[model samples]
Target: MKVRAITGFFFVIVMLGSVLLGPYVFSVFYLILTSFCLFEFYKLVREGGFKPSRESGLINGFLIFLFFAAQCYFPAWKFIFFLPVCLSAVYIQELYKKTPAPFSNLGFTFLGILLAVVPFLFFHAMAFMNGSENFNSHIPLGFLVMLWSNDTGAYLAGRAFGRTKLFERHSPKKTWEGFFGGVIISAVAGLIFSHYYTELTWQQWVTVAVLISCFGTLGDLVESMFKRSINVKDSGGILPGHGGLLDRFDGLLLAAPIVYAYLYFISN
Candidate 1:
């Protein structure tokens, strides 16, 4: 228990520091994060008796993330046109390998990219989401705060009042009680954050909070499903007690993209 608490404390400090430091730190942190996630994902898939193109997928996934980042930083929409061509290299490389399950290889390679790389790419936009051409840490910081709040609330509430299972097959411990508990806590947090982070109104922050709670829970379930299917307990052991990068950021996988879409629509 002490080890877990210690690891979690340092983990939170590093993540929050990177996000708060500035764009370069945030970008570099997430870039390394995305790469590690994709690498770990491919490793898990390989453990499931499938050979994925690890090298090509990693390189292409990194490039794709940079491509999106470039789209945000530079006036380079035309550069995005190269993404398809780069992705195609995965297929093209697979053709020459003479692997029996070429198609399966192709599918999982792209899956890693789509699942790990694509979702996180939108996080870059959150910093510049206001259309003011300036970077604001609060947007992403609020997201982290709400996400952590939901998780903390669910843990406490679920322990205290959990009864009915939310998804018995994928995640046996989750309960509807905990789910709603997380929502209520996150909603309250959103309302409170509105005063300090004035980028959005109270209502908007609440909406974002609800989205994180709902989708974030779903994201946890999805990762649980993946691990269950693969017959693994945790995604990786990078964190002493927190399981893996995927386990930690599973909520962001689905929530970040959806929140990005929501913010984009409202801002534009």
Candidate 2:
């Protein structure tokens, strides 16, 4: 247990520090994250009684990821229009092949992109999400701090006084007590960083906090549902105590887009 704690702490510092560095560093983080997440997601699909072409899935998934990367690195709003094109390409390519009953090769391919590629884009989007003036100089770093506050509060409170379940059916590990604790912690963090993001009102900042805590949990549950459906303990072995890439970012996947949307719509 002590060893796990030490290892987990070190891992968090390195990962968070790299992520906090900047957009260029963040892009590299997302690429590696998307790649490993795709690998773990494919593992889940195979477990669910569908055998997809590993080479095809990885290739197609990475290509879709490239589209997202382009949108971020090059600033292409047309990339949003490209989603259907990419989805269709993946579907048609997979459906053409032979497979067994309930064998929707296209379905697995589509799911992979949705789960793996889509969320991966948000991290990049958040980094580069601002217009010229409204851009928070500390955007990526501030965003991650909000998320970490959520997790930290949830973990400490949950350990101290978590008993009732949050969503017992989907995720046995979550507790309602911890959920509320995370929300409170995130709100506090949002308030703290409210100055850095001068674009938002206190109310808007508070809303962001609530969304981060609540939707963050939703994202966690979504991944938990995926893991449960496939009967796996962790998504991968990339992070020490965090389990996998998916495990670490499960909450942030939904939270990132939301944080982006808040800035995009309200402030911009």
Candidate 3:
């Protein structure tokens, strides 16, 4: 556990430093993480004796991640249109092949894709905005920082002060103390980013803080539900202490699009 902790700390720091540099840096990392996660998801599905089009999943997942990556560099909304089509096609094929219950497994899989893809879109959108204008380009980095901060606070507080369970049935180790700690800590991080990093006002920061606190928690829970449903402990073994790339990115998956949406609305 100690070794895992130490490794996780260093790995996180390096990833943060690299990701914040610009699109090239973050894009490379995002593609790699998504690939690992998609592979893990595919593996889990196959192990369940349900075969999803592995080719489509990999191609679709990679295309989705790369599209967001390019969204940072380009402004084409056309690619975004293909996401649902591609994913739905994957689900439809699966349904026709072995034919699961009406919209049961297929719906589950499609929903999973939405949950996974949209935030990544936001992450990329931030980069594009950053390049196009300097008014709030830092929002992308700020959003990611808060995500890391959320996890850090939750883990530390949960270990130090946690007593009461938050959702004992869904997740055994999660405590209410950790939940509040993550909220407070992420809120603070959001405030600091808005105050010092971006030109956004206090009101904006407060809004961002709330979104991060709420949506980020939802993202984490979503991943947990997937794991629990599949009777798996970790999403993958890619990361040591983190369990998998998906495990580490569970919150960011949701938070990224949310923060982007807030910024987009504000920008417009």
Candidate 4:
């Protein structure tokens, strides 16, 4: 218990610091984060008796993130055009490897990018999402706060009053009661953030909170499903008590894109 608390405290501090420090720090931090998460995904897939193009996948995934990051810093550059060439390399490389299941390799390699990298791309976009190409820490930081609030709220609420299982198949410990608890807490956090951040109106922030709570829960369940399919308990053991970066940020996987879309529409 002490170890979990200590690890969690440092984790929160580092996450908050990364956003508050400014664009360069945030970009570098998430770039490394995206790479690590993709690596972890490919590693797990390999453990599941399948072979994914780890090298090409990592390179392409890094390029994909760089494409988005570059857009924020250097929008005029045509880095996006190179993406197809990079992705095509993945397919072409498989033609020569003569792996037992080339197609599966291809599928999981791309899946790692889609499942692990794409959402983070959206997340990285959130910093400069205001349309001015300027970085604002409020949106990303507030989003993380609400996400953490929802997780904490659900845990506390579930422990207190949790009878009805939300989804017994994928995650049996979750309950509808906990879900609502998370929503209520996240909504409150949104209202609080609106007072200070002002990046979004109160209602918009509340809506984002609701979106995070709902989709974040789904994201957790999806990761849980993936781990179960592979007969593993946690994604990895990088964090002492947190299992893996994926386990820690799984909620952001689905929630980030949805929130980004919502914020983009409103900002425009």
Candidate 5:
């Protein structure tokens, strides 16, 4: 428990620092983070008796992140033309590997980028969602707060009064009670964020919170399903109690994109 607590403390510190330190640090930090998560995903896919193009996948994934990150500054459509070129490399590389499951390798490699890398792109975009060239930390910071609130509330509430299983097949321990508990707590966090951050209205923040809590749970379940399919307990032991980067940021996978879309829609 002590080790877990200590690890979690540093984790929170690093995450908070990354966001608050301005756009350069945030972009650099999450860019590296996106790569790590993609690498981990490919590793897991390999463990599941498949060969994914780890090297090419990582390179292409890095490019994809850069493509999105560059948009915040440049906002040019021509920057996107490179993406197809990078993706084609994955297919061409697989052709020479002589793997029996070449298509499976191709599929999982792309899946790694889609599942692990794309969400962070949306997450990174949140810092510049207001159509400003400058970075605004409020939306990203508030999103993290609500995300943590949901996780903490669900864990506590589920332990205390959990009865009916939420999804017994994928995650046996999750409960419906925990889900609602997370939503309520996240909503409160959103309400609180509205007071401090005027980027979004109170109602909008609350809506963001609700979107995060619900989809965040779905993200967890989806990762749980992936782990079960791979027959692993955790993604990796990179963090003492938290598992891997993938495990830590799994909620962001689904929640970030949805929340980004919502924010973008209302902002525009």
Candidate 6:
């Protein structure tokens, strides 16, 4: 517990710093994060007796991230044309390889990028959604705040009052009581954030909080499912006492994209 707490403390500092510091720092930090997560995904799949195109996938994934980031800050739509070309490289490169399951490799390669990289790009989109050219950290920062609150609430509540299992097959420790506790805590945090941020109304913030509670839990289960399939206990040992990057950010994976889509449709 001590080691986990120490690791989480510094990890929170870097994450908040990335947003609060500046856009350049935010961009660079997520770029490295996206790349690392993609690498980890490919590594995980490799353990499942499949070979994904690690090099091509990482390159294209980075390019795709740049594409979305460019759309947020730059004026050129022409750059998006390059995405197809990069994707094609993934397929074309498979032809020269000796693997019999080339298409399987191709599919997993794309899946890794889609699953790990694209959502983060949507997260980058959030920082600029308020129509200001400068990157505003409040929206993204509020998101992390609520996610952490939900996790903390769930942990405490589960330890104190957990009974019925939420998803025993995938994650046995999760409880319905804990889940609702997280929702209530995140909802309250969302209301508080709306008071200060003001970028979104309180109702919208609460809705975002609900989405995070439901979908973030799903994200965590999905990552656990992946590890279970591979018969591994943790995704990787990259973060001591915390499992891996995937283990830490699994909630953000599905939640960010879904939240971005929600905010996008409502704004439109």
Select the stronger candidate by lDDT from 4 and 6.
Answer: 4
Put down candidate 4 lDDT per residue, 111-217, tens digits, no spaces. Answer: 99999999999988888886536799988999999999999999999999999999999999999999999999999999999999876789999999999999999
Tens-place lDDT digits, model 5, residues 104-148: 999999899999999999999999987648789999999999999
Candidate 3, overall lDDT?
A: 0.72
Tens-digit lDDT track of model 3 for 141-254 = 677777777777888999999999877777888888998898888888877776686557867876777688678877888788878877888877767676877787788777
Ranking 2 against 4 by lDDT, winner: 4
Q: What is the Å distance of residue 65 in model 4 from its true position?
A: 0.4
Name the weakest run of 10 consecutive residues (lDDT summed) in model 4.
73-82
Task: Report clash pairs, candidate 1.
Answer: none
Q: Which residue pairs collide, candidate 6?
A: none
lDDT for 9 (candidate 1): 97
lDDT of 6 by residue, 1-268 (tens): 8998899999999999999998878888998999999999999999998899899999999988877776666775788888899888888889889998989999999989888998798788889886648688998998899999899888888999999999999999999999999999999999999999888999999999999889999999998998898888888888889988999899998999999999988989
lDDT of 5: 0.93
Candidate 1 lDDT tens digits, 200-220: 999999999999999999999
Candidate 5 vs candidate 6: the lDDT winner is 5
lDDT of 5 at 213: 98
Candidate 4 clash pair list: none
Q: What ordering of candidates by lDDT runs from best to worst?
A: 5, 4, 1, 6, 2, 3
TM value for model 5: 0.98
Q: Which regions of candidate 2 fall more than 4 Å away from where they truly are?
A: 72-96, 132-137, 196-199
Q: What is the TM-score of each candidate against the true structure?
A: 0.97, 0.84, 0.82, 0.97, 0.98, 0.96
Q: How many backbone clashes does candidate 5 have?
A: 0
lDDT of 4 at 204: 95
- Worst lDDT run of 10 residues, candidate 5, spans 70-79
* Candidates' RMSD to native: 1.2, 3.0, 3.2, 1.0, 1.0, 1.2
For each candidate in the order shown, give its overall lDDT on alpha carbons.
0.90, 0.73, 0.72, 0.93, 0.93, 0.90
